[model samples]
Target: MDVRSSHPLGQHSGSEETGNEEPEQSVQRQSIIPSRMEDVICRLKDEVGYKKSFDVVVREMTLGDTRTAFFMMNGLAKDIALTEVLKRLSYLHGENMTSDALHSFMNLYVPAVQVEPEEDWNKMMTNVLAGSTAMFIEGENRALIIDAKSFPARGPEEPSLERVVRGSRDGFVETLMVNVSLVRRRLRDPRARYEVVRVGERTQTDVCIAYIDDIADMELVESIRDKIKAVHIDGLPLADKQLEEATVRLGWSPFPLVRYSERPDVVASHLLEGNVAVFVDTTPSVMILPTTFFDLVQHVEENRQTPFIGTYLRWVRFLGILVSMFLLPLWFLYVLQPQLLPPNLSFIGPSKEGKIPLVLQFLLAEFGVDLMRMAAVHTPSPLATAMSLVSAILVGDIAVKSGLFINEVILYMAVSAIGMFATPSYELGLANRIVRLVLIVSVAIFKVPGFIVGITAILLLLCFQRSFNRPYLWPFIPFDAKALLNIIFRMPVLESKTRPNLLRPQQRDKMPTGNGRS
Candidate 1:
């Protein structure tokens, strides 16, 4: 009916308007739930399974002489809060509760945090299923929605992928509120906003768009909101990744357009830089939009160290990423075209040809590495290390020694795998693996031309890849020397003043200066 767009972490703009019916028609049409309480109960039995499901609890009680029922899922609504609510409502001793008494009860009696009214079945069902307690009163035109949601979640722990040696160990947990609180705990800015949007027709998943109102680009924020609203998925069982596919629309691109972080400090840092954080419910990882190539390549460990050490770390990481992408391709070239290598470097190519051709060797090696990676993921934690060691030592050594794979092939493949493991983003690493395989195949087929063409094609693709309409290559393709240098080197926090120019943030100043614009 009435819909609006407002700031995040605040009251919503309104129920997002779908435009199926007029605002007046929304109230006039009682298609799903009837106006009468008894009819509503009957509909719940037939539609919402009030009796058939054991977990669905409908607690009927007399409220101020009015027949009332509280509907909530068993595990979602907290027992203590529900008990408190029922106890307080039992104190009502007057005649049937008028509309005014119901309003008073919602305002004064219910100590639970969130309370709202709903009439439509669509909105009511969404709230009821998403851990909120729904209350229906006899003779009332609307039903009460009390926020009594509780989720099974673990305490924040260090992220397995993005762990820092010297920074805060507390990372985001599965709970949306806890994750938001983690960010708010670090970022106390008054302008910091977290706008909530519910996606998924069946799941009714809550996705929060977080940014600083003054510093973030309004267009960027609006773009994310509009795209999220357009997501017509029935459910987002995969959570953030599913939402990413819907919004980013990154069709066929192996590279990640959005950066994901489980660390709160990492999220707060991104928000301050004018990037919006898209938080999906039931997920610990938050997605940072308008990310560049450098964002995925970077790790928080660099920032945790001193400036000089941080710069060294950043450079080392960049080198590792480069090696992961190109080392195998270059090796393939050297093996085929030994004349291209200098006398000193000519020794780099494989000395002995194995039973399999170099091309097949590279392909099989790629498959083996990926197979081990997938196996490590599914393997138990205690055995993962041992399994990896056995696979690397026994399997790799035996393959090479038995002439199944040449010694040089095994060595180079192991080196490439090491570089891949050193990469900060697992998604990016996997993408690099695919690209590496492509390069190997190309070099194997066309030798010199394939090597050149493969590199050029990848560069063109990176240049074309857009992150929320911003250049994914950023300072490289568009060429901002200063920004590019900053991405390569970790500068002290105090030295960094201007927000990313690419974002076109409303407020350029990070420090309190006269606009602080460069």
Candidate 2:
């Protein structure tokens, strides 16, 4: 798992250019950062595959007759930043450049905000690869790393999934710096901290952890940090979702332990409530960690409305999520035992027979819905209306008339699908779909016993599940009355004083008592 294999771009050869310095083999054996300018460039050219890659720019310049090189990736460095640094470095002459002039240049002339000394070749490689600018000088064992990283990303637009009738339209973009700034713009708290981690040995993709110092639990933060540090993957192709699966230890659990959001307001809200936000580069969805089951069910739109309206919206969403998860299975269970159906609800079961078993109808319908969903994603905007019409007319109507699906079966499945779409978190929706399938399969085979057992198994799984050592089924499993009530109702911001005790936040109160509104 040590991804320190032969460098992918490296061109290993004799160090003929390293005049009067260690041989290439000797340099490779020691893996040392040498002080000689020729030896440094020689080693780097071989390691970075400078000949093979054109964008890996190594601009050799002189500061007062001392040979120096500025290393950066072409598209990553901002033109203004690079030009400013170049203008400043161009002015240096005479006695300013001497032994340890690298330190003096860094101390006085370096205009970059984040500058650090790096001596390890491994660290230097990682930094320069991650859009940072590295400065190396002759006769110096250390290099200055300028944190001038700007990733290619789209400007923040309204998030399609987490949109609100009223609030900020700007959402988290693929760029990590912009995402961090969005959260910082909201809180403006000095205690807010963004700790960056370099994940993926080859990709060296930047992952940032955002949390408020005193407000967030340090133990929780440390646990999350340690788990991310423990991730030894070559690359996270799926980005935050992959990182979530690795760090959260969610093995085959259908429930989502961590919630995701693209909106900065949502992330900022959770940070103030002692939750940690994990931002992975090239991904807009930021992972909010140590989240409970109840947390995923709540939506930001609830807070955007008045308390009464918010409570109403929250309940509607809660009902939709519950129905999406359990409605079809319970209805099928009723079909399995029609005798148990109340006289008023006797019409629920399918009245007509099909080529398939009753449970098979639900399964096929589930797959059919998924197929349509996938088709919609790939379908162009202009063709989307036509696609929907085709699906509705050909697929839905033909399936019903052809008796592959009964009227009751199609009706209930459609209802359940609606509920799934209404659910706030897409991850939770997918998980609920799996749960629904399990329940349907159980109800089909063993009738009442299988249905009971499957439900119990789900409950057990949730009961045992933990997100970073915090109970997943919190407030309900541990029975916290106040917390449960808060989840059910969106209380006015002014009335709510205490942060959740479950998070164990350093500041018990949201604001000092004197800050309360009249």
Candidate 3:
């Protein structure tokens, strides 16, 4: 049924401003809601451009003897719900709404649970644009803002990056509420808080900081909160990554300051350990803060298996990560100084130098691998297999056979690439590739001293790095024997009953006697 009524165009006789309102201030910053319906409609049309945008819908109708207008953004609010609200309003009579019409309409007409009265015109407009339906009564000083936000979203499918062989299939979605619910389902503690802060000026994107009020360091939470509030950007178009750059101020560092995981279980586990999780709207990945190098090395699959199996898997991942970062550079070092290799181990270097210089061959191979990887990412899913086959069989085979690269170079590059893929954190993997290239260039230039200086420089950089004031290297750099041991070996969950000392959580004990809640 059509609920719209034609509003006769009339010249707006603006009402007197409140004594406290400053006339010198910009009209957009003014908070007062106009008492005149004509003025309200005119301002909405002029300021919000209701007449210009097709999605900006304004339903005008007579409720009893009072004229009401509902401003809504199209496709944001539920149709059936608004229809029911309108139907309820149709039952109101001139007699019942004769006195206090605004009060009667709010307490009796609207059926939604999340309704509130908003007095500020700027806030009302922001709310209307953000998927709320605002009711502007003929003579009321405030608008009734109805919360009926229904953003387009997908189901919580398993994230492609954090999939496991044995675990819950559900993962965080792009919707903020859904992602919060996913974490709340796993953690039912009343002390768990999801504090939201709006960051962007134009976009006004929501960023939630989730942590246990009692367990999490309030100072850390507050510091993060202040940083988010202090953001002066016009929009958060890139979501978490943009926020990370704004807040962390990561200058030239290639390493990630925060660990990202789409798996709710991973986030929940981090919260349990007194770490904070930041959930950004429109992104499935949740950023875990105060992350160390070891945290990036960990995978949920390790915890899914038995203690011994988990330890084994952790060791293998460690080995792969090490190889991905240093294997190519170290192998090049041996080739540069063949005497460094024992007589029995001298078979490592290539038998014959290729047409290209040895250093140029490595650089070319790295660039080609990165190019193919990017091409595969952009390629259609159906054609990805063909692309891979062409890269491996046509490009790789032709290059090696033509002596553009020796057989050993191709083999080592492939091995390093495989190790890079095995890395759990994609950001860390890319950072490792950069480090490998740095080491390779150093070895090519200054030989032995270059390799030593390169390794020492990288180590010192990491040693001095900090994530939210917590040491980035953590257990290793600070020399926490027990924590380092835990990193080296995956211990049983039940046996490990204390939170990380680095976070300095308010609550140190994880397994308290009564139901395990703070």
Candidate 4:
């Protein structure tokens, strides 16, 4: 037995002792499938550990007087499908597998769409572990890798975060192929492509980069592909989040570099807009690359409604987001310096100061709200109402009564919280929360100057920030009036005639006609 890293496969570093070995020796290190059945069985038993791992199944059987071995993960292999294949193979006789056994067996017996020959031993084992059943014949040099994997997955329920009043209720599930099918069902264009890339050396997680070849910039697609390939990591256990962190150089900035969506419609819409969608296996969420600040702010419901209604909803949401980030800080500033307020608005500040400072009260209230929100997530549905009631009673009523929080602090915090909840992107909401907290602290210390500096710094950060080399604050910082207008108002589908110019798409016009109206 070889002593190596605790990795389940007992995998060794390829780089180690490579310099001393000759080129031929290094090439030889990559073993091919052995010709002899006994040799193959013995080697695979030792390498894959049939006795050690309960889930790794190796079924050795005599098919048409030919010895064959089937390597697969127990639960992953579709039992019914494999049984059908085996039933066909069981009917074979000695003469059926006499010459060209591998090709004959594959072409005649195997009834699978994704079945293919794999020559490399390491790759065959990897395929087996990844739920593909690998079939090795007695005389065949190459093995037949059967795609009979069936992962445990929930039905495509509507995504909780990006739900629309009137749209497709079906959302992306954890299964990669299923998610791809959802997208394919919507976008039937021949040019739409879903290129699969296996990332994570150990995990070998499947990542699909989806884009329309005709509409999307080839350079952008290649750039994203290269970045993903360059990620030399052991695994992507956390799925898309880990991949996003690895591919996108998102430094200390709190803002999201990519827009995440569980809705296939949203993903398809982005693909039509020339933006690339990255789908990670075992995770429902798909990442839309080169996202702008306005992208995070928009919702699917806006597109579902009429242009006028959608624009109104968009404006209300925008207002909510602004109020969430700035209302508390501004209110606190006013409480600190009453002179800043105009005649009618002079009564905005707290009537009487609480035992704690206005800033501390605001911070405490924010923390309590966040705590309650998290608690609600962990709490069962039946208890959620009771939990909310208790939280409201304790934080809202009792805290003010006990002189811990003033009425104004509670009032402004509640409004701010509503705005935060109204925000479409959860990541953007969290980022804004952090910014608000920093602003609150700044106001506590430097009063007026702090608010000014904090805002300016945030604007500078947004202006400088880039998502996949594209402006984060696009149509605003770079100043595209046409694009900016579209962001502000929900443009009707017919009105949106061009692909986003920022993406540098190969095809600019979305519709057939080049004129202003069709």
Every model: Cα RMSD to truth: 4.7, 6.1, 5.6, 4.7
Q: List TM-score per model, in order.
A: 0.92, 0.90, 0.94, 0.94
Pairs that collide, model 2:
none
Rank order (by TM-score, best first): 3, 4, 1, 2
The local lDDT score (0 to 100) that residue 371 gets in candidate 4 is: 95
Total residue pair clashes for candidate 3: 0
Q: Please write out the lDDT profile of model 2 over residues 1-518, one tens digit for every residue.
A: 11122223355453435563345545543444667888877887898977578888888998777788988888887668878888988888867765668778788888888999876678888888878988997887778999887668799999999989998899988888899999998989888999999888678888999999978899989999999999999988779988887888778787888898999999999998888999998899999987888988888999999999999999999999889888998988887789989899887777678878887788989998999999999999999999999997898899888877788888888889999998888888899899999999998899899889998999999999988888888999988999899999899998888888778888888866564411
Off by over 4 Å in 1: 1-28, 31-35, 95-99, 514-518
lDDT of each: 0.86, 0.85, 0.88, 0.88
Which lDDT value does model 2 have at 26?
53
Per-residue lDDT over 1-518 for candidate 4, one digit per residue giving the tens place of the 0 to 100 score = 11222223445456545754354344543466777888887887798887688998888899999999888889999888888888888898997764788888888877788889987777888888778999999877689999999888999999999888899999999999999999999988888999998999899999999999888889999999999999999999999999999999888899999999999999998998899999999999999988999999999999999999999999999999999999988988888888989999977877788999777788889899899999999999999999999999865899999988888888888899999999999999999999999999999999999999999999999999998899989899899999999989999998998989899998888887554322
Instruction: Report the poorest 10 consecutive residues by lDDT, candidate 4.
Output: 1-10
lDDT tens digits by residue: candidate 3, 1-518: 11111111222213314443233233423556777889888988888887898888899999898899988998987777898899988887898775777788788778988899887777787777778899999887778999888888999999998889999999988889999999999999899999988888898888999999999999999989988899999999889999999998889999999899999999999998999999999899999988999899999999999999999999999999899889999999999999999999978898999999989999999999999999999999999999999999999999989988899889889999988998999999999999999999999999999999999999999998999999999899889999999988889978898899999999888788787554
> What is the C-alpha lDDT profile of model 1 across 350-389, one tens digit per residue?
7788999889988999999889988999999999999989
Q: Tell me model 2's lDDT, rounded to 2 decimals.
A: 0.85
lDDT, model 1: 0.86
Better of 1 and 3 by TM-score: 3
Worst-scoring 10-residue span by lDDT in model 3: 1-10
Which segments of model 4 are wrong by more than 4 Å?
Answer: 1-23, 26-30, 513-518
